[model samples]
Target chain A: MTVTAPPARGAITAGEPIRLTSVNKTYTTATGPLPVLQDIDLHIETGEFVSLVGPSGCGKSTLLKIIAGLIPFDNGTVHVGEQAPKEGRRDVGFMLQQSVLMPWLSVRENVTLPFAIAREKGSHIAPRVEELLELVGLSHSADMNSWELSGGMQQRVALARTLALDPRVLLMDEPFAALDEFKREHLGLEVTKMHEDMGKTSILVTHSIPEAVMMSDRIIALGARPGRVVGDIRVDLPRPRSAAMIATPEFQDISRQVREALAGEDGSIS
Target chain B: MTTIQTPPQPAVVRAETVPHTKPKDPLLSRTWVKVGLPLLVLALGVGAWEVASQTGLVNPITVPPASDTFAAMIDLSTKDYFWHAAWITLQETLLGFLIGSTLGLVLGALTGTFAVFRTALWPFIVAIQNTPRVALAPVFLTWFGFGMTSKVVMAAVICFFPVVINTVAGLSSVDANARMLFRTYGATTSQTFFRLTLPTAAPVTFAGIKTALTLALLGAIVGEFVGASEGLGVLVNEFNFQLEVAMGFAVVVYLAVIGLILYALIEWLERRLITWSN
Candidate 1:
């Protein structure tokens, strides 16, 4: 079955634009407080596809968590739409590196878990679930247990679950990093397609330069040792990106720029 | 051109091995070596026992022949009094297991979920659990009387600790990522407990339940030995008093069968409920 287009956004449920102003986060270590992110300022427009890329310990995942309201910052204000970020916000969806599907639950049940957590009745969300499963190309495996599916299938289930709430903003922390190269590229294209189709504001935390170029409208590079935004490059490439775009000059140019930013060559922004 | 790729196959890949070639198993690793050889040994042991009894190689009065024990078992199975005693013990075991496991589950959940309960109740739980519970059989008889009540109480006490410990471990050891997912979904505490925590805990808790079932039987028998008017334990004692050693062995066989059935029942239930767990 074909995936039906998601309903158009109303004013109240429109894509949530995110803004971070001088946000700082620190972890209390055995020795002292170690700052992970410092004076971070970022703004994402509604319906934009953005990627955060950096070296390890750069706190890109932490930044995604901050936007998703899964973690609190030590200082400064962060906003999703007009309101401050809050845990369990219905308008924000978070996907971790692992698919994190419950093994005991079937794929359909895992997708509908958000609704179950919210105490919503099953009948109202059944059709939406079917649409989501179809969107992720998992309609055939909906009745199968989460563990019975392959890693990519499990992540598809996770993606479907994140979309279960129809959240206006999607926060993905290297969601495809665990899969094989082919699976990663395939899922990357699927996510890019889904982002365009749904028109939901998306922020992906990835280490791969080509992935950021292939999937994102804007790529934000972060530096380590108290991670701060090092560079912000716009991808002016056309819509409906594909794997073949990776070999294109425009994609290569954008990826090279991101690599330079990650290497601290573009210290002008930091 | 944008081309959507078809989904990949499942991750598992089986290597193609050579056809019609069987790998030779080690001598002791074969099925007959593991199982049939043990049966042969058992048959030989039984034959030796029968020969020893017939030749008066050992004191027949104390050892009794294997045949005598088998005959006693068949004889006891035909008797109304023996069946009555067996029924009484079964009732006590079932009731005790149900009550103890239920209480343990509730208490374990409370202790595992709340630190206040853990702090307030753990020391006492540990103390009671560490004590020689079999010694309490006589005390239970005094407190709850010498009937099935005392036996059931004793069995319940014996069955409680393992279930409590396992439930706590299982509940606490849930996947942290899954917990984060639940938090992100705005799951209420109870919803998280029921959907994620409880199901995750089932396999471990079922292990405890299996252990407790055996202990429940032991507890009931110990309680019966301490003081009981009717039970398999009492029947064994009665046979011993009358010098019916074979009949005593028959009572032991009955206990073994009951234990096996209870354990198997629990295993079946575990498989049915927690199919996802290995």
Candidate 2:
């Protein structure tokens, strides 16, 4: 309930005070209007790292998309910063499960894309590109295209691209789910560190319970079908979470709570 | 930016779904074996023809030996008139290719970008594309005369469709996630088109260009058939009048070799432009 704090005023402003009040979404299937989300309310404070974990058909991605202003909800007011998600989208960066890096462009060009779109061609953009690549640890492979890099490396490039615009709120949809466990844990640590460094609010939609516990300040677990927040727990394990922390009791306990929340009445789905 | 995960659970990543761009040795992949195999078949075909002609099994008048035709080609290359005619054909083919590809690319991009424009003009474009180029050649000749203009226009018009279809396809096949990433960043329509859509479509467009370039030569030849002062197509027709079958065969050989060279040039450009070229 503490995490359900009211969003600040305005639907359009900087990326702060992301608020979703009574959000509802229904997808029209061949059978009829199938409600995907119902009466969901959540609030994320500035620079807070939150993870939404749930079973399949929980509308977790839909929720992320709703927050991202990428899809229309049947009802409910969602606000990013003081403005609507649509109006304030410029300050919202997104990372998908797939690398989504343009294969034809070099790693350097892919990351620089948003910069070029947001601003005119200027000398300043080059340094920004370097800074981002350094942040993502992709400084060496800047000249190579996605085909030349491994999946994990390509995803890192995507992370760099998302940050290129310097959005205040980052919406991640299982960004590292496709990566192996070793990579998933490695990237999970790096991303959390990066999140702390940037002080940007992030909402990660993930299926991995441990990942949610490892990186999140708060973990929101949703039930199956018409997903509603089933469990909201504060991850007080500590900041700058390490790979070793995954083996600790506090991390295990937090992840267990998340898993239990994910395992709902529809137990088999998770 | 946020890619969809339909199922909340971990779906196993299929090994076959992802494309592997492992570069096999470029030279080794396109080995001499591949080249030699085709040459070996061609040799067998030509040798059989030569034997058939020499044994009087096939009439030399109707089906001249490959040797006679190749010798005619060598002899014709020495003639200033043949060179001038081949040069004219090449010029017409190239000019037509350039003009047609430009028109197709620009128009395709424009229509692809705007739904209203596509809806309004697509019918007309389809009609023009479907009209037989050979049927229209005589009309073009009447309007522009038997000069290179008619041939060039014909070549351009004939090759136009491939670029349009391929460019539009390339433009549409842009990864939805990439488009969403652009939209999430508030990229303008022009920005998305130029940055994401156009670049993604470039390789596909280049493929279309290759097809169009080859077709350009065919269009030029058809134009020459309508009426022309000089061209390889005209040379074939001239030889036909005198019943010089070997000479006609020689013109065809020159055309095929020219087409092969032009196709190779397109492949070379594709290697340079396409970042993920296999």
Candidate 3:
């Protein structure tokens, strides 16, 4: 599936783009320096849902973290919206693989945490909180704690929180990978809905072929043993992709293409 | 309500780590059981003791009958000296626990967040914490003189380490995911500490405070045993010196009551602060 760049602007990004140049990273594990991500260069246009799909040992998560500036990469430059990663991280919204909701806080409180931390108070804040909760179909559970909700709903809370900052560039490190297949597919669509409706530029790191193919505008497959970009396949699927899109011939074909690319590699790809 | 998709199974994130809802409560394990069982046992024990004393198996002067001790307690309650002494001990424990806990919390937070601070102070803290607090009573007396200051200081020093240790552990052990989430929000170190770290640390910190309350009582009593003009500890000493064992037992009962009240208060606050935890 070859998707030409859409003409419409993303809600948050508009024309803001993410660029990485000659990035190399090696993490100091217990034994020695483990080379994680090799020298890589990539560019993501504004408002694109890009998926970095790879096997377990691949540096897919490392790449996402570097882009979010949660971890530093050696000998490279990463720019999000014309700013280096460290500074760019401040503007980018990040979602981790786990549903990082504070169990102590209510759904509304968890979502509006960015506002609370910033001491942002306005008549507008409450309404926005309501809007985000409603967007995730969690308005009824706004007053409930995350622990009272299911895993999928917890992930939704985390998604709501990522959107709370209203950032242009969203860096998601396998946000729905922890959920069961049913929820993963369901939330995969929900996330696509989020990206399409909000028009925020998003980068999703996942090992799931069908998930990457169904949700993202482009799938960047990474090869293992020092992860590097091997395939960058643009998805031609239309906007507002739904669960129904999963069964489409085009979606399955692209998914198979991503799978073939992944399975073709020497390393194990699940 | 309109719903997109309901997650079929409600397996909340880390549900195994926390008890979200109350577990099944048998009729035997209800809140009323918690409140009633102790009182029932106490009454039964006291009745047996009183009966034994009445039956001439127990002596009043050596180990006072439960009735005599109860009578002494009632009699002491009317006396100005008992109230005054109780108030002094209460004051010492309250002031010392408050001051020590605050200092401990602040220091623990600093050390917990920064490796340098932990490394710098850990050896000294561990060395001091290891020495029994009882042995330090003499040093406290020599340094601060035989006044209430010495006693209060002793109480503070004794209870300090538990709060420090618990607060540090609690703050440092805040779930890694929560900390990462805070960082991705671009929260400042201080913001993360205050918002995420502090609230997350609260249940454990309250646990420390609860532990410290008992230690505070012990410290205050130990200080009074060493030297003090007033306190429940002093009163107990006076009763023992005068061979009024029943009155001594009564003073101990009063101390137990004070400990219970303080512990209950802290437990209540802990429940309030981290409702999701239990």
Docking class of 2: acceptable
TM-score of every candidate relative to the true structure:
0.86, 0.83, 0.86
Give, for candidate 2 chain A, the lowest lDDT window spanning 10 residues.
A1-10
How would you class the docking of model 1? Answer: medium
Instruction: Itemize residue pairs with steric clashes in candidate 2.
Output: A10-A82, A10-A83, A11-A82, A11-A83, A11-A84, A12-A82, A12-A83, A12-A84, A13-A83, A56-B8
Report the first chain's TM-score for all candidates: 0.92, 0.91, 0.90
At residue A8, what lDDT does model 1 achieve?
40
True-contact fraction in model 3 equals: 0.50
Better of 2 and 3 by TM-score: 3
Tens digits of lDDT, candidate 3, A1-270: 132232222234343589999999998888999998898888999888899988877898889888888888889898887777762243588888888777778889988888887566777778888988998899999999788999999999988888775777888888887899999988888788777876778899887787888888999988887888888888999877777777889998898788877775666666
Ranking of predictions according to DockQ: 1, 2, 3
Candidate 3: the clashing residue pairs are: none
Give the candidate number with the greatest lDDT. Answer: 1
Tens digit of lDDT per residue, candidate 1, span A166-212?
A: 88889998999899999999999999988877789999998788888
lDDT of 2 by residue, B139-192 (tens): 999999978999999999999887887776666667788888888877887888
**DockQ, per-model, please?**
0.52, 0.45, 0.41
Best by DockQ: 1
Q: In candidate 1, which residue pairs get closer than 3 Å at backbone N, Cα or C atoms, i.e. clash?
A: none
- Reference-based lDDT, residue A155, model 3: 91
Query: What residue runs in model 1 are displaced by over 4 Å at the alpha carbon?
Result: A1-14, A122-124, A264-270, B1-52, B55-58, B123-128
